[model samples]
Target: MGRQSILIVEDEVIIAMELRETLEHLGYMVVGSELRGEDAVRSAGKLRPDVVLMDIHLKGEIDGIEASDRIARSYDIPVIYMTAHSDQETLSRAIRTQPYGYIIKPFNERDLYSNIEMALHKHRVKSRMDGSPEMVDSAINMIAGAMVITDPQGHIERLNLEAEQLTGYQLSDVEGAPFFTAFGVSVPGRDLLIEKLLVSSEYGAGSMISFPSTIQIRMKSGGDLLAHLSTALIQEKESLQIQNIACLIEPCAPDTEGRAGGYQGAAALVQAIPDPFACVTEDGGVLLYNDQFSSLCERLGDGISGVALPINRVLPESFIGSLAFFHEILVDNQVVTREKMVKYSTGSIVYTIRYLPVGGDTGGSSRCVALHIRDVTAETLAMHHCERAQGESQNTDAAVEGIGDLCTALKEKVLAMSTAYEQGLAFHDTAHERLAEVNRILGDIDLRLIEIEKNRWV
Candidate 1:
């Protein structure tokens, strides 16, 4: 918020003094001046000025350009080149440093002020673009409640840290096994109904089904929890078929509504995700989808239940074209991530898509895939605008620089013409004097010739 400080790195004592005076007159604080490139580099790293005015030809072996490079790599400070030399090789080397501005010497007050201000503005803009991290791992690990994601066929695909703590099973040991086997779930009174629902054809395809009775889940450590069970289906986008299932168990209090008709706890975990999530089969069937997915479908005018829209229909065309990349996860069983940009009538939307393969086989292919989609439109737009701002700023600086160069060239040509005109005037004055002298000599010779003729006649 205060006046910007500048570090002057010039070899010539008079020039450096003049530069310091000019900067101070322009309301910039001139920090300690350094004549040597090595000294300037050290000072820049220590003082950390807003900008550095570096002279191309420094006193020592290390030139201004080299010092600027070192400072740039370490401190990211903006450097403006001050040089009288305009040779091709020097220009090329200086350009590689990408100095904010180049001031051709015998620079005036106006040139110094404009270049320094522009460099400071550019540096500030760049600082804003480079911000802090978006997400923190410690924050995610602190969330309460167990979360379990399973493949289309009900195999335990993943268990979060909370799920591991609650289920008394490490993810590495229980992953790829059936959910019931991993957690050891048992419905004491409604065993028959649960068995039927678990093996039913509709359940395999990720149908939403819940039990009214209390369910008991036993941890591997023999600790048991009595909870109400619920299930939500994640469907594949292409086939309108189910791909995965999410099961939520809540400790049901006595006198709570046990009839499964309107109870919401079963799918509450899946619904808690802020992003659209789905589980798809290896063959592209919709197994399970969260409420966010349903909302997204409705917004896109593609009904999830009525028309069974494929994943491609829901995502942008750019994302759809990369479907093969998603399928590769099933083959290699590694997580694949992709980002897509979509333009709508309103504006552009960016989606960060992550495809995670599911199923428990060590060497075999995965049976299902889980997709977590994040709407990163806001962040993406911010980044785009930032880049565009930086570019426009650079373009503006370049235009100013071009104008300055043209002015400098014009000034040089004008000086050259003035010098030539002065020389011509001097030449003309000398020629006039010589002509008068010649006339005077000729007149005297004529007089002498006349006197000689008169003497002959007498």
Candidate 2:
């Protein structure tokens, strides 16, 4: 495939040229470059680039924000804003354009690449969910949870894309199959059956039903996934008779709290995550957490069997800085992340914790925040090792040059013994200095690890 194309729109010639060079260096083809919003809009409509980098301030009658809005309304193109403007009025106007991302001026290459990649991914996902569907198939696919609709007799009628993906069976393959055959659900250490749950009495023609506990669903491929299942009886409006039963299954982790309602709806989904994660109320009460979280708590000597404990008390002192970020979530209503190197007797471990607001709204009205903790020690250590190797390679090149100089001195006939001895001493000193530098790096790493351990306990 050809390189992804980009269009640059900036009133400033220098910034536009520099941005084009950066994009080309990053392997993106710069298809069009324009200084005015009108030209940009015209070029975008004609060239149809993969993405556009637009500066909020432009030279013509319409600004970059207005141009982006026009392009989006006309061609569904994604536009990323680049600007130095930080005033509220400017920001308010830029946001209304719904740009893919906003990058502050003087941003690094990494920031630009990350924003473009994310914007492209989001655009692709949105495109996938916008295709035509028959009946309520469109609505079904839009749901985040897997759903299957069955006839009143409990025969499979329709299943959404998520359900098909989860069960490893397409809707066509399971069209006439009984709900049990298609979804093979079972409770661990219990004799519960999918048929038993579908019986009319449990979810009668009149009422809906919710699974009492977390159940393990066996996919057609023979793999098991944990989920929370709920059912609703669809009724015909005119006859008031049951039409079909809709089974909604969402990923969830098992909970000891046994709390019911909307909280459980997405609880198992959080638990299914491999990372040590927890959802806590704004006031610090634990709402839901995965088994990895419980295991981490045990390792830290924090009792986490209950539903209500301040997060500050559950994690080790290594998390004190993370706790402050959690507090900041309520203030900025934005995701806060922290990475810390931890010292253990065996070696150092690096942990990164992120506090993400539960809901999409950035308003402070969000009542809960989700905490995700991951051990990035291996990657962090690998990066350090790579840097150290590069430094050592440079030192080796310098030492090779010194050796070449010593050889040249020996090859020249009139070289003095004293001078040769001095060169040898210099070489010896250089080697010693390099060794010391390495030791210093190691010492610094160790000390940082120790400090982390000390702080963790405090």
Candidate 3:
């Protein structure tokens, strides 16, 4: 109807006549219908169609699939596949042809028309969707889903790149086969579903259970396959109608709730993550507390849940006094911060208490006391440990140097004794004095070690 001419390359005479009649009824002009692959290839030179319907199991040396490929490559026309055999190997070959969709054999006029219409519609939709700014839409066309467009009769009218790849039917081989044949085994209660759709609104949709079967297909050439599948409905215009369909099958984090959902512009870049974080309100209240807060209490052996709901119930005694200073910030609606060492039952933990006050017409709203309590205890300990390590390293280096000096002095003393033995002079007091100094240095170092152990809790 829209100047889209179709070329039908079907071997069967009755099937070819039916195809031409269907094409005419659907408002598509048929350029040619050839019974053999060689004749179809020759017809391509005489009559050009917007699309070719190529059957996989066609007559003669050049099969319909191969002939379509040659015509498509040389003349640049799109092709649809028709086939009775939905075997894996034949379908694989059909997909390589990139036909629009397959119409199964023994198909009715409605089924044939639906296939042609759906293929044309999908081609149009692809062009329209690509005009959008989103790259995601284009990516959808490439995903591994069987894209079947069903008419009001539940007949497949259209299919896309993925459907061609999945079913293994050449568009020409099965253009008229019932859609049920494409599905092989029947769906349970499907007849009931069709009845419900007749009673329901046009946009109404539902799912039906399909059979559990794997097909080992044997083409005339003998190819086999076993595929698992289910069926769903999409009655609305261009509606996304399927089970287990991911619109975007790529890496993207979807925020369905919270501040993350509200984050616009730059906020999307700097939101608090899953671990321990704080959100300070304007007036004065701890709006949210997460798993890390509970963990902090567990380490302290205290059941800490309620104190901060309005505020933390089990807050450390040190933090309680800081709260008064924080209250003043709320009164003045000003921000104030205090870092304190919070004591648990076992030991003390350090926290940097940051306060952000909410200012209103009169004063602090009282709803806005955003206490950003960070557990800086680990960081503080790490810094202290690093300092102690460097200090010990320096001390050890000094001690080793002292030991080396002691060794050198002792060797010199032995030489002095040998010289005294030869010259009959005294080498006595110098050796004793050197040994005494070495012992004193060692005793001083041992006392320092004891002092370090005394302050071990830090």
Candidate 4:
């Protein structure tokens, strides 16, 4: 091998140039560079490089996944995917292409170099296998999920990178160990289940079984991971005997909340929120939640032991009644809001419930919903006070208007009295009685005006 050659396929010009320089510095020959998936496929066939570094999202009718598929089928070249997206859907699609390695973007030079060498080595090993069952080892390493392969006696033969990370145990430490002991599988009838699976495999090749219940994997770091267990028996074609037992372990819940130490950073972020926050699955299962959420559940008289329980089991009945709203948010992928008042023996508390859809395409089904509960009792009470004050202000304005009208009527009466006095002077004897009556009426009017003014202020 004179020098290993690599091809770069990326949409970003700057990133492509930087990757090329890095590869050159790492002593690998840069065969060619392409921006579009179509061009990358063409170049891969022509250049026939040792490894093709392909980006998942490229600028063309075909994405890097399709291009890699075409290259693998046409040229049998190993392609190592370079991507920034780590979503389940994207990973599933890329894994289907059977790439030699998958490296996330913004990686250091050591990561790039190591992945490149590993891809080359795995590709060479696969080629040397020449259609042997051991070729399955390379395929297993490429999978995105945790996997473990055991011998016919159920002793661990090999485990994948994801399995090592999930269990916090290396292959050197767990090789030849019993599967259950190595994984710390906690099931009531686990021994019987394994015996049945082994006995059933004697009947024929390709015997497989899926564990129905959830499995709790005890990690090396003294933590437990809740996962779903699936196993398939691999038999020799000629011997028709059980050769190996392949076990695929998947999280019992969604990635947002599953795995013991998988989402520590996200968990910290959730814990930082002052309000009660939780990520609830579509089926009302609690994934990630903060301590505030736990306290809220306790306050509601539903104390939960751990985060693995269903949200309905611990939340208030009012929240359970909002199942329709939760379904709507998951279906429509929209934010919804409602208010609920929980009355305890002591007092009542008001909460503004917000449901926001998370991790799904627009107009598509949501993976889960984030539940944020805000204490808005004080805000609600302040709003009520402001509304009452406005009502009182309106009433005061109406009273002042009435007082102004009364004053105008009093002035008119005074003007009429003046005219009567003038008439009394004209007809001295005739107007004398009228003047006396006017004087009494004027005194009554003066007393009534004073009373009205005093009442208006009060």
- Candidate with best TM-score: 2
Question: Which ten contiguous residues of candidate 4 have the minimum total lDDT?
Answer: 203-212
Top-down lDDT ranking: 4, 2, 1, 3
- Candidate 2 lDDT, tens digit per residue, 104-194? 5555455576557645654665545433346457656655568887887778878988898877878887787787556666432211222
> How high is the lDDT of residue 181 in model 1?
71
Ranking by TM-score: 2, 4, 1, 3
Give the per-residue lDDT of model 1 (tens digit) for 1-458: 79898999988886788688878877889878999999999999999999999999987979998999899889998888887654656655665565666665555564576567546644554434322222211222332345566776789766657767766788688879988777767443332333443554332322323443344577778866656555544444334344555565555333232322222232343345568877666666555567787787666555476223456666544554345755777777766778877668888788887776754332335655677788988777777787977766665565555556645655554555555556788566555555555455455545545554444443
**Over the full model, what C-alpha lDDT does candidate 2 score relative to the true structure?**
0.67
For candidate 3, the lDDT comes to 0.51
How many pairs collide in each candidate, listed in order?
Answer: 22, 6, 43, 0
Which ranges in model 2 have alpha carbons more than 4 Å from their true place? 1-261, 317-325, 360-364, 414-458
| Structure candidate 4, residue pairs in collision | none
TM of each candidate vs. truth:
0.35, 0.40, 0.31, 0.38
Error at 140, model 2, angstroms: 10
Query: How far out, in Å, is residue 303 in model 4?
Result: 1.8
Q: What would the per-residue lDDT of candidate 4 be over residues 180-255, giving only the tens digit for each residue?
A: 8887774433333345546554432332344533457878999777676656565554555667776778664434
Cα deviation at 129, candidate 2, in Å, is: 15
